[model samples]
Target: MTLFVAGLSHKNAPVELREQLAVEEDKLRELLSDVSATGAVRETLILSTCNRVEVYGVAEAPGEARAVVFRHLCRYRGVAYGSVEPLLYTHLDGDAVHHAFRVAASLDSMMIGEPQILGQVKDAFGLAQACATVGPALHTLFTAAFAVAKKVRTETEIARHAVSVSFAAVELARKIFAGLGGKAVLLVGAGKMGELAARHLVEHGAFPVYVANRTWPRAQEMARALSGAAVPFAELETALAGVDIVITSTGATEPIVTLAMVQRVMHGRRARPLFFIDIAVPRDVEGSVNTLADVYCYNVDDLKQVVEANIRERLREAQRGEALVMREVAKFLTRQSDVEVIPTIVSLRERLEEIRVGEVRKALARLPGATAETREAIEALSAAIVNKILHAPITKLRESSRAGSSRSWLPLIHELFGLGRK
Candidate 1:
């Protein structure tokens, strides 16, 4: 069977297209069920993140599997298949293995070396297994991918910097102020990344002016714990004008902070300058808001370029990680090849042993007057001959796997040894 991965990522599509296809964890099982029902996939995984939507699977034909995956994504997103067909990429066999390893290693991230994708990949794999969409093929693929990612993490300095979108927002905020000290900040969501960004702001000496969440109690508790005043969720736009920095990570599907909303807030500030960091996947702030005067808006994808400054140093190490992935893939394939020949080798050995034992038994039966020592010697002699006779062909069959050139000789060997269907 051929292993394959088919999907679209940040390299081929913008966030506009990506968000349209993004599947939440709640939809994972349903999506996997539909994909598996297509009958093209033997094993399957759907990895849906902010940056990508990919399906990895094993099938007899790679093209058919890729088509099934692409069709599923289009159908799930309610988009025309022709519209996204050009954007999708498919990798088969070794290339598919490389894609998986690179993705798990975070090398394929928009912000290369970012650590979040590794966890995201793990979560997708876990979710697929939980849904029972995965069997040994995907199991082997993901486990190897996880191992490669771990090796990259422990062996490389790529992720030593806190260079995620959240951290990038804080860095941009710092560029605006000589320092973050005394700056008034408003954190709009209690999202994990947003909360992390708030902590970083506090570290940089910025003061939390407001914390507003959709849930009032969470906003109140977060505000109190962060030493900031809680604002009613309805007054989010009102809170925007007063704060120097706004970080939003709301779960809203559409833009919450639109250009008109920012324009209304900017009027009250009188060109005081408002900085917005929207770290949400679907993006809380409107894309057009970045065009507003005296306003700086940065979204998750915008952080991609910001991360490259530190990433230049990690390229050499990434090459080493790539080499390691290739090596691991080779070893895994070799082992699989070796496993395929085991039954044939066992059958051949068993057939020879049957002959040796039968002949020894016949000789023992004919020698009723023979001593016990003589019978033992005859049995030992027969066993030794069987082992020596079987050794050469077994060794050759096993070694042939490493060279990957055994298909022609395997059937011939089986026929020559009269080993089949037993």
Candidate 2:
């Protein structure tokens, strides 16, 4: 398979551009179906997240396949192809394989060693499978990447330190209170980031004051899961007064917690210190809320800066991950190369067998009145000669493949035998 990946990420594009191309969970099937509908790629998978929007595919014409991907992405996101083309990065074949492995292991994440990327990659692969966009080649590629990611995780300490924005929120909370032994936390939304923050808080001894969400049932579910009481959506302001730490991540288009709301909540508390971590992209909490007296607010970018300082602590572990991914890429490439190599060898053997049989028949025909035993003997000799001639090279090819080396022998042997291009 001519595997390729074309996409943009936080490395080149800003969050605003990335979010423009971000594919929501609900629209994945439709987008994947559109990608598959183009007939440019034989197999496809889309990995769209807050940090990156990448498309992986296996196609005969990789250049054309990539163009189709860009076209579909631009059309779906309602941007001109020219608008986003400059932000895109393309990886082909071995690079594509290595990139996938690195991404699955979280080595490519904004927060290196953040574990959530592995689950997110799995989710993308799963949704692709459900949409019937992923076939055998992609399935094998993804499965191998997943295994490599697991191996890297278990062997390295890349994830030993807290490196995510949510964890950074927890760290900030600790710094504010000096400790969270008895701090009250209000999770203003049940989004993944908020849930993660809530878990980290609980793990650090902060108790959830109340879980609030746009939906009451979801709030109830998250509250129950975190061992906290659910607060009705309308009464989030009332719940705000009791907590010292607040983490909010919601999907609302506008801010859900206004400056006025926080100010009113603060009036009742007699100037007690309040901390808010707004992890949502559009920001569930208003920016002006930070201006209120005795209140401190941090957004995603703020938490990222804190996480960035801690990334150096995991760089050594990331080096180990890079080495592991390199080895896996070699193995994956060896397997992929054999998809063509094995068939070429088989074709060469068959071609040789055809020549051997034709020569044997001519030789037998020249022998007048030959017995059946003589004919059988001639056939046996021809078979033995063909097998002996091919055995050494065939065995060497298979053995070298197992050792993750000598794949270059493929083109050499192809040329030596006058085999046509694969």
Candidate 3:
């Protein structure tokens, strides 16, 4: 059988198309049944995430399997094949193994090194297992893929840095404070980005959090969600004096936290350090505030710059991960080829042994007076001849499998020996 994967991802398909093909966790079994009903593949697994929808299967005929999977996907999702065909990709055998490893390792993600894809792939595998659709081929493939993913994560630094603006802000805070435990945080806006940054800080052990927004009710809502206190808009300047880290993402047209305001807050603090994360479009904090002796300010652009640098570092680590994945792919392919050819080898040996036993029985029956010693000698001689004759072909088969040329001669070997299907 041949292994294959057919799918479309963020690199090729748009979000709308991906949404159309998305499968809910509860409906995965139904989808697996639908693919099985096609009779195009022996074993199948489906991976349907927001970023990609893929079908990995083992088939006797890979070309037909690929076509069937594509048609089934379009029908299942109610999409036109013509529209999606151009965006779809298929990888066969070794290439399929390579793709599976890369995906599980997060190398093929829209944001490489993100940990969610590995978990998503594992979820798909579990669903397939529960549905009884995963056979030996898919079971081995996915299990090895998971192992390779773990190795990549442990050996490489691909996921060591923050890649988003909110997370980058938190990383900067961690560096400045050496740790986030007990650090006072003030969130100055109720915007989504600012809320996300505050959540990251709180999760990392920031305490005594305060939310200060222009609107009192929104500030109260955010503070309640974060399990913190709401500071009234009138106390914004006073709140600034008490906090160690400040995140501002308001919709004001002008600078809300001016340099003079921060200077005044810093005067009575006895040279305490302050950090500002301004993740707003029109610049929430004045650009000049970063010039203060113990005050540091980073706007949205600055956070993005940090994110970009982190992404570059991830890309460099990804190169090492890619090399690691390729090595694993080669090893998996070698094992797969051996799996494919072992049955044929066993069948051939059993067939030869059966013939040897039958001929030996007939010869003994013809020699009615043959002694037990003579019978034993004839049996040993026949067995040795059979083994000697089989050695060359068996060695060749193993070598061919390792060379990745098993397909070229496997069918002919089966035909010559009248053996079972390869």
Which number leads on TM-score?
A: 3
| Model 3 whole-model lDDT (C-alpha atoms) | 0.91
Who wins the lDDT comparison?
Answer: 3
Report the Cα lDDT for residue 311, model 3.
96
Q: Alpha carbon lDDT of residue 390, candidate 3?
A: 85
Q: What lDDT is obtained when candidate 1 is compared to the true structure? A: 0.84
CA-lDDT, candidates in order: 0.84, 0.86, 0.91
Worst 10 residues of 2 by lDDT: 399-408
lDDT per residue for candidate 1 within 1-422, as digits (tens), equals 78899899999988898998898987778878887888888889989999999999998887887787777777878888887888889998778888999999988888767888999999999999998988988898788889888988888766665456677777788788778998999999888888888888988899856899999999988888788888998898888878999889999998888899999998888888889888898999998988988899888878777766546656756777777778877877777778778888888888898888889889989999999899989988998988898889888888886676667658978889888763
Model 1, C-alpha of 300: deviation from truth (Å): 20
TM-score of 2: 0.58
Positional deviation of residue 171's Cα in model 2 after best superposition, in angstroms: 12
Q: Which stretches of candidate 2 lie over 4 Å from their true place?
A: 164-310, 344-386, 392-422
Clashing pairs in 2: none
Q: What TM value does model 3 have?
A: 0.78
lDDT of model 1 at position 390? 81
Positional deviation of residue 183's Cα in model 3 after best superposition, in angstroms = 0.6
Structure candidate 3, residue pairs in collision = none
